[model samples]
Target: MTIKYPAGGMVSKDVQPVDDDSVELTLRDHPLIRRYGRLAYLVIHGEPVPAGRPRFTRQGHAFDPKRSRDYKKLVSEAAALQYHSELLHGIPLKVDVKVYRHVQSSISKVERAKRLSGKHRPIVKPDASNYLKLIEDALTGIVWEDDNLITDVSCSKYYSDDPRIEVTVTETGAKRPNNLKEPHY
Candidate 1:
């Protein structure tokens, strides 16, 4: 039987009878799997939107503002396109995200050139952590089982004419080493 991938294309599944009462279905080689192996790299084109502070009503109910919700939706949709059928579960993951914002139009040509050339990066708010937070929340359940499974995270921001967010998730085999010395105090 053929199963369709959400993004596009079709993958053929082989069915084998395990017993008289049951059968096992196995997926053949998928394009995404062959190309990226176990790692998932996604790029969302457009301006990066940082997660905003939660808004509270008079009754003390907290809610996300429209902009934050919209950005999260955008991220979720983008992630869905590259999602694999099996979810990454019970394994430590490492996530790397790079957020690129367009350079200010009011800036001088030289400044814009510098920004585009990476000589000057975006050091202004909202902070890089805010962008990372939004991405992590949006990718929950889509890319992996949960964001908490991510043991290593790296985030960066840059200025560019073409604004976009790039995310890379990979399974980290073996636990990271702890090199911290005992406290003397």
Candidate 2:
């Protein structure tokens, strides 16, 4: 039998021949496969915006708030700069997102120093999950095929003078361990 590669290379092997006598392996050199097991990094240079609650109109239609939409667009643009084509699909992924919020100007110099030094973190509203939600939705179709493929995620928020969101994505090679214990019943 003959195996044909996408790069116009053919290799003859002593294997069972199918009816066609030629086998074409398409995914061997796919872009996603090439990027598998590697890390993808991106930074959105601005204040990190968390996913906002959906707004409903009197007509019973649901829509993302203007702020949320704008933030998602910004995130998508940032991700697009790093990845041009071939979104990852059907692969487990690990995502780490760090959100940096600007320190309040009203705080004292000592408090500002503490915030900038990472000694004082942001413990206010718009939790980490909300930030992750916006990032995941924005990255969909640009970084990966779907957000559900992300098997592991870590998110944190901090106060910084130069506010931004840093994202790192890696394709997990194998099934991740599920730490849930079986029910004793």
Q: Tens digits of per-residue lDDT for model 1 on 77-111?
A: 77786554567778788899999998899999999
TM-score of 1: 0.76
C-alpha lDDT values of all predictions: 0.78, 0.79
Q: In model 2, what lDDT does residue 108 have?
A: 97
Leading candidate by lDDT:
2
lDDT string, candidate 2, 12-74, tens digits: 544453243334434435444466634567777767889999999999999999888888987
How big is the positional error of residue 8 in model 2, measured in Å on the Cα after superposition? 42
Q: Which ten residues in a row have the lowest lDDT in candidate 1?
A: 19-28
RMSD of each candidate relative to the true structure: 9.1, 14.1
